[model samples]
Target: MLEIIGVGVALIIAVFLVLAARQPDVCHIARSIFVAAPPERVFPLVDDLRAMNEWNPFAKQPSVRNVYSGPERGVGAADDFSGDAGSGSGRIEIVESIEPAKVALALRMDRPMKCSNRVEFTIAPQNGGSLVTWDMKGRQPFIGKLFSLVMKPEKMVGGAFERGLADLKTLVETAREEAAQ
Candidate 1:
């Protein structure tokens, strides 16, 4: 009886491991919003790390003390930040920059889950405003991928992205309104 129970437990463990290993090791999500401001105006805001708190919804205080390297706010520029556990410590390096169009960032985060990802912001001029798209992509370990499946990273993070975009629209639109007035 004891031998039979042991074999059953071992089988269950093996099956669970196999299933976990089969999960996708990569995931990505994107969210976008249109702002009643030109890409040129919005582009500069994204380039400046110090200004992120103004638009980043995930950041509660939105303010962070960071060590910076490279240019003030362009390709090769990087900033290091240590925040709360949920916020984590991380560095974002500007990997690509195309004026008023696209900027790609390499993000490395510590704590919570140690991972690196590619985050990009793209702006398209449209009818005196701009369409902005925020994209994120990362590859995870088998175990990490399995965990995300249960936790739903897209739903968790995507909601924040949506809010951030909405806030950005408000900020930019408000600035435009003030300028016009």
Candidate 2:
């Protein structure tokens, strides 16, 4: 009986490994939203790491504690976070910024998993407002690939990206309205 159970477990592990090996080496997740505010109006909110706390859904979690380092905005700016499972722990640094248009970040996650990823935000003028896109991309190691077999990276992280963009839209549009009054 014990031998049978051992063989069952081994078979399951083999299946999981095979599936993981079939997954793509690189993973990417992206979500976008349209805000009823111009790119200039929406740029500052994403450009400054400190300002992210105001609209970033992840930062709103009660267990998440954030600390800022480097400049207030532009390259060298970073935010370090420590939190519960819901928020995880990571350090995000602004490695590139292109004013009212693009911002790219280097993300290093420590807790839950140790991996480095790239995050990007692009703001473009559209219909008098702005079209904003949030993107994350990274190379998945064997362990990460195995995890992806259980939880697709796109579905797992894309939802949060969508919610974050929604929150950003509301915040920016509301501010735009208030400013016009």
Candidate 3:
């Protein structure tokens, strides 16, 4: 009986390893929304880390703390988030900032796992408003690949992006309307 149990556990472990090995080396998640405001009107919200946290769903999560460093806003600006709950410890910094159109960031996770990722926010003029897209791309570490075997990483991570985008849409659109009035 003990031998059978050992074999079962071994088999499960073997299968998990095989599946994890088969997982993609890269992971990409993207979410987008349209705000009833021009790119210029919406640019500041994303370009500034402080303004972004106002609409960032992750920032609203309980137990997360953020420390600002480098610069107040724009390129070279960094935010080091430290905490044990929610998304864990990470450092996020703006790598590129293009006026009223695009902002790119580097995200480095320190705890729970270690991996470097890229985040991009793009604003484009469309349908009388701006089409905003947020994208994250990263190389999956071994643990991340293993975790993906039992979870859908895209849905798990993209859901936050979706919520953040919704909040951003509401904030920008409401501000736009108020400014017109």
Q: Report residue 45 deviation for candidate 1 (angstroms).
A: 1.0
Cα TM-score per model: 0.86, 0.95, 0.95
Candidate 1 lDDT tens digits, 1-181? 9999999999988887787788777779899998988998899878876575568865554444577888988898888877776677888889998998998999998766788999999999998889999999998887677677578788988988999989888888898899999
**Local distance difference test values of all predictions, in order:** 0.84, 0.91, 0.90
Off by over 4 Å in 1: 1-19, 61-65
Q: Output the better candidate (1/3) by TM-score.
A: 3
Q: What lDDT score goes with residue 45 in model 1?
A: 77
**Location of the lowest summed lDDT over 10 successive residues in candidate 1:** 57-66
lDDT sort, best first: 2, 3, 1
Expressed as tens digits, the lDDT of each residue in 59-170 for candidate 2 is 8899999999999999999999999987889999999999899999999999888899999999999999999999999989998998888887788789888988998999
Per-candidate alpha-carbon RMSD to the true structure: 2.5, 1.3, 1.2
True-structure RMSD for candidate 2: 1.3
